[model samples]
Target: MRILAVDDDLHMLQFVAGELRQHGYEVISAENGEQALARLEQQTVDLAIVDVMMPGIDGFELTERIHTDYDIPVILLTARHHIEDKERGFLAGSDDYLVKPFESKELLFRVKAILRRYDHPANNTLTAGSLTIDLKSYELRSPNGLSFIPLKEFELLALLASKPRHVFTRDAIIESVWGLDFQGDEQTINVHIKRLRTRLEQFAPDVKIVTVRGVGYKLEADS
Candidate 1:
């Protein structure tokens, strides 16, 4: 992955760049936000690690610009540990934030986590016939209009949409949607699926969630 590290401090910039490079990431170092923007215009960056305090644009402005222009993930690095600073970073469209004097391992982990979430294959928008899912905005739209579904339900829909017309057992659905750490029973999966079906029906009344006799369920594109 290509990462752009923007900081005014030469030592800090070099340190972060070197550390990321050691982790098998392509590193691009910039002394200020302008340089970072220039680099971004020239190349495609997978992620950006931006320092809050810079010479011209600063981290907040840089994050805002990047988010406005590109949907790339950004991690804000700041010495200010206050909640206000963190909130400002988030408001400016930072995907994650880390306080300065952070451990290299922690920084690497945060970067990896944010990148993993940003590049999640299952998170891609899913569509089944007339039904549409905007994964980034978590918006579900059918032929009728938009429908409101909670996070878990949206995930369930995405998982089911990933493999349409295939019967997924109840146990398999629970494991895939709720995760192995989930202590809920198979009934929980059934309940969520029921709720999801109800919501989808409001948008596409013809949509069908098929049930096999002893097996689980399959989301059929058309009713």
Candidate 2:
């Protein structure tokens, strides 16, 4: 896979690029956010490793634009271990965060983990009765037509649809959809499930998001 590494520090940029290259990834190096944006426009990249500090178009802004325009996952690199910085990175749409002075092995591990979650399915679609969940485009297709849902909601629906009728515990849902570092509670899962149920009602009457009471949720299709 191709990875874009953006950092103003020449030494750090070279280190990141070299590490990724050694692992068989095609690494693209950019000195600043502008160069990173230019590289993005030039070709398709599977993931991006962005430094949080830069002169212009800081990492947060760059990450937001990448998330909005490209829909690609990003890992934000920061020198600070402050909670505020991590929160801001996440708010800016980063998929993960890595503090500077990190070990090469840790970096590789995080990269692999994030890629695993973002990997496209072989079929790239899941079906529940009349509803078709398009994993690639994050759109739900039904008899009515294509309906675009929120990203988290779509992910929740897709997870349930992946194994219809199999109850997924709240913990599993949180880890798989929101990542293991998710700071929210079970209530967060409830909120997304609620939204998914509402959308399924309007878009796919034949499909259902079933609550398992003390357990969690499961998807069901009307026979």
Q: Identify the leading candidate in terms of TM-score.
A: 2
Cα deviation in Å at residue 16, candidate 2? 0.4
TM-score of 1: 0.57
- Collision pairs in model 1: none
**Highest lDDT against the true fold, candidate:** 2
Which whole-number lDDT from 0 to 100 does residue 156 have in model 2? 81
TM-score, one value per model: 0.57, 0.58
Structure candidate 2, residue pairs in collision? none
TM-score of candidate 2 against the unseen true structure: 0.58
Off by over 4 Å in 1: 126-223
lDDT string, candidate 2, 123-146, tens digits: 899888999988888888999898
Candidate 2 backbone clash number: 0
- Give each prediction's root-mean-square deviation over alpha carbons: 13.6, 15.7
